[model samples]
Target: MSQFLRSSSIHEILAFFGDLEKTRLQSISRMFYDKIIPSSLQQCFLSLLTKDKFFSYSKEQGDILYYYDIPTRTWIDVKAANHQEHYIYYSMSAVVTDLNRVLLIGGSFDPEFEQYTDAVYDWNQITNRIQPLSNVPFVSFDNGFFYYRGYVYIIEGHVDLFNQSTVRKTARFNVLGNYWQTLPSLNHANGKFNMCAFKNGFIYAFCEQMSSFYRLNSNLLGFERSTNWDLQYIQWERILIKPSVYFGFKMAVFGLNDNQILLFGGDDEFNNQITHSPISKEFSDANALKILDLTDLSLHKIVDDANQDLKIELPDMFYFNQLSEYNGKIYALGKDHIHIINLSKKEIEIIKDDGDYNEEDY
Candidate 1:
């Protein structure tokens, strides 16, 4: 097609679909579908942009997939549809598998969503499609997903007041049996301020109460608190700039081979914006990602030149949350894009296109 016709055709198609009915909508949607999508897909494609529940992850083939709105319609490289699935309210949560499958935990969005999520799916790495796995009684979102000890851990919670309490609930999923099992109550259940797991048989949690910090033993059936890193024993050093907000997201702790934990990006009690609700008084903006050496409690910023390279304005919104070490390079996933941190070269490169960075170089 010529440029003029191609441009005009899209405009005409948009206009036609703008006033389409359900039957016509599906027909037109199907015509545009380059791939087959099941009719069981509940959520529509356009609604995904509005909802934050969709999952985003990079595949083994170096393709970025956004499993959004509808299960059967997957977005490739954050663009239009490239693949599809047949599910709804799936935990946009993404985890890597030994064979390289993308595990997604989904749940019903009913009242149960706050208390329970009973669905899970595994997206095959070879075909770029998703299949149901097992279900959990606790919803995935209520408790964030963390992979440790060959199983995915789901933490549960309920918010009562705007900024006051985020009650901690708990559950675990067995990858082998595909079932949900309850765990002991969190020692500090005020609300999950932020949490991450380390390979060193421990999961660390910091709360919004500002009174306690916890180190949960990974081996214990229930998350048993390790009293060594509790609140009263914490040593605080003076900082020129205090991280004022929680960033409403979990702080990521990366475990290095040298028995050191890299603590990066967490909110101090001063910033309330980190909480899930803006209606609450505890909302503030945090944009800095700090690296704390667990060995000596030494602190440093991940990006030395924030203004020049990082360009981070909102510490809470656009910060590194997930770090994966593949092929000797560390790939950090931030809010907007992925950064390839060359620890060897002490440099950073933003991954915009799938073809831009060769996987072999990692």
Candidate 2:
């Protein structure tokens, strides 16, 4: 048994345990499960063991909410129990807060309207019900959305479709108060940029088009000194180092730690010029996984053991891909597969979604 534990691959060990009785393998599985199972399997096992779930609601599937059951290898649709008003919102931003709810932010509700929406909704995970929350002061879509402390922040994004103009505006929604307040605007107008907040009280925003990076100190001391306790004063400062330019849509960015950020797959717009629009024929997906070191503003491409650039394929052309971190592993949810990324190991395991749950269903 000792030799089997050490010498056997995680998959092999799992297979061996599968043949044994539950009573015989339960304690053993608990003991070495973290090592005996692959990272993807570990995610599932941990989800079951901890009763913690990662919820996902795609813009393409605006009405339905789904969570992956890693152990069963299935996407379970927990029907929104109280979602009576079905409105299809596209290009929206979603953030899962610490309060076990998802806040869906600004998006275009209808293409015919040609107007962006400021509507916000809180979807309860436990009740599987969605309730309308406070709307944003400004209407926009394709914005940078994040949740920090007790507030939900939205950065620059497309504001007007007629002129194709973007905004540098920043705003935060107080979750507890259900009120929206505009914060200091960015120096440069940007849309489709990536933004994330760190526990260190700094919010980082990166625009690939302009090769610009900005950091805003959200702490009371940092804000008071910079703006004299004035919320309307400009607080965003352009960092000295800029991120490398990469043009794509629906790119995923998440902070790995206080000093590291991981950027994942997106639709490579330049490579697939024919499909420039979301409604185009064929979309090209960029697979490069890059990590930006916040300490030095150094961006490096992540590669596998073979010294080859690691890639993640985003199969869904219409929906924005979701990248989430749980239990130290990054989970990239594409249309067809879930890529379980073990950054520490520099390894990624792709698990194909169940065939029955296709895009057409949405």
The ten-residue window of minimal lDDT in model 2 covers 273-282
Most TM-score-accurate candidate: 2
Instruction: Pull out the clashing pairs in model 2.
Output: none
Candidate 2 residue runs with Cα over 4 Å from true position: 1-52, 58-63, 70-72, 84-86, 108-116, 159-166, 208-210, 220-234, 240-243, 270-286, 313-321, 326-328, 353-362
Give the top-scoring candidate (lDDT): 2
In model 1, the worst 10-residue window by lDDT is 353-362
For model 1, residues 1-362, the per-residue Cα lDDT tens digits are 57546534433333223212323544665546424322322133333112222345532322345543222223344432233322224224565432223576545343334444457677654465556677666443434566653467665533444655434655567665466665544544434534444445555554332223445565555433222334333322222213322333444445555455544443342344334323222333233344545555454555543343232233322121356555455555544445455655546566442322222321
lDDT of 2: 0.58
